[model samples]
Target: HPKFDMVMHDLLVLLKPKFVVMDATFAMEGNGPNRGIVIPMNLILASSDLIAMDKLCCEIMGIDWTDINYLNFVDQHYQREEAEPQIIGEKIEDVTQKFLLPYDDLAVRAQRWVYKNYFLTRLCFGTPFLNMLQGCLNVYRKVDEEIMGKEWVNKYWDNSLPR
Candidate 1:
């Protein structure tokens, strides 16, 4: 029931893990992390700092950095916020490209409205239908690229599929 914007902050406060790694090789589009259309991206990102990794993930996902909750939380709590994380392996540009945002502007705005004005999140967490809907929306999320696309899918994606 948590919003995407808040996930990073929540993770930092709760988990405080030593490392964070993100696999965006086959990320989702449209509704995502659950129900969105999956796209072949071929990317792997890692960082010692959770905030940095989450920010990078948002960038690759085409999510506005300003709108992400965890990033904001980190900036407020951690010093040297702008310092870039050390890139131990592939650079971001080489491995990834911009993908579509999960939802249209209208839907996003509406969701934000519900979150801010209607106290919908409280209800959503308790209700089965809302929970299920959120689950479906996020169903395609956190999935392996291999599951979403074939080995050759990335090569032929642009030519064969709709953007």
Candidate 2:
């Protein structure tokens, strides 16, 4: 699964932009931007450092920065030990409050249970059908590889096959 901050980092790397703005007016909590509950907040955040912006967003949403995997990964990878982010626009204490976490504790527990169970995933994705499809694709690839390896087959069949 792609983390939010990692996606943002990749975008920044590709675009090499000067600044980033994030809308935290309605942000997610507990389980996230998609699946979690949306807390109505009136907040706007911006930063040159995407990681700091993400950390600030999480903080505004009442998420513990340590619990967020993306921030942890960035900090570890970059070895940025002293990268303390400065808030410029608004004071955190004045704007943010403990918004409700998306799902109740019981729902979160159930979701975790379903996620950890192998059978649940298999059932969702149809394991046997997927296996069969993968097997067929592998067989086709092997046949193509063998045919391409033979000099005569390469000269003849290469003309027939689509590039």
Candidate 3:
């Protein structure tokens, strides 16, 4: 995670915003930061201290701050020790909620790994014809389901259509 740490350090050094404000009115859960279902919780958070802010956000998210490498990077670069961040408004316990983590299926893990590895992704998808593979896969799955008389797709579509 060196590259991620480097990027974060550069941003903090360059921008140097005095305070950070976060809208916790809704937060994403399950396979995110990105790509997850949104959970609505009416809350707002603000703090001048970056580490403190992140720590509190993690607390609110019910995740361990130390588990995030970038948070560790912040701790080291700022020489700040872990402590109870000075919470200005409501106590964190009042707002905290457990979020579901990413789906742990092997296919999901492999898909994510392939996506993160640029060389593998390019090798698989960069070819002129191969670039259309994802679209083709979707088409094939649909066709196969229909041919096999799988009724779930129709059920889902019927339920989801404008009523």
lDDT of 1: 0.67
Segments in model 1 whose C-alpha atoms lie over 4 Å from true places: 1-10, 33-35, 62-64, 78-83, 104-163
Worst 10 residues of 1 by lDDT: 1-10
Ordered from best to worst lDDT, the candidate numbers read 3, 2, 1
lDDT of 1 by residue, 37-90 (tens): 888877777777866777777766667777855567667865544565677666
The most accurate candidate by lDDT is 3
Better of 1 and 2 by lDDT: 2
lDDT of 3 by residue, 1-163 (tens): 3267768877887887688988888989987755788999888888777778878788888999898888888677854344566667777798899877677678677766877888876776666556577789989888888876466656566665677
Every model's Cα RMSD, please? Answer: 11.4, 14.2, 4.8
Tens digit of per-residue lDDT, candidate 2, span 2-64: 246577556655776557897778766656655767767777777777767777766765778
Question: Per-residue error at 64 for model 3, in Å?
Answer: 1.5
The ten-residue window of minimal lDDT in model 3 covers 78-87
Worst 10 residues of 2 by lDDT: 74-83
Error of 2 at 65 (Å): 0.8
- Residue 153's lDDT in candidate 1: 73
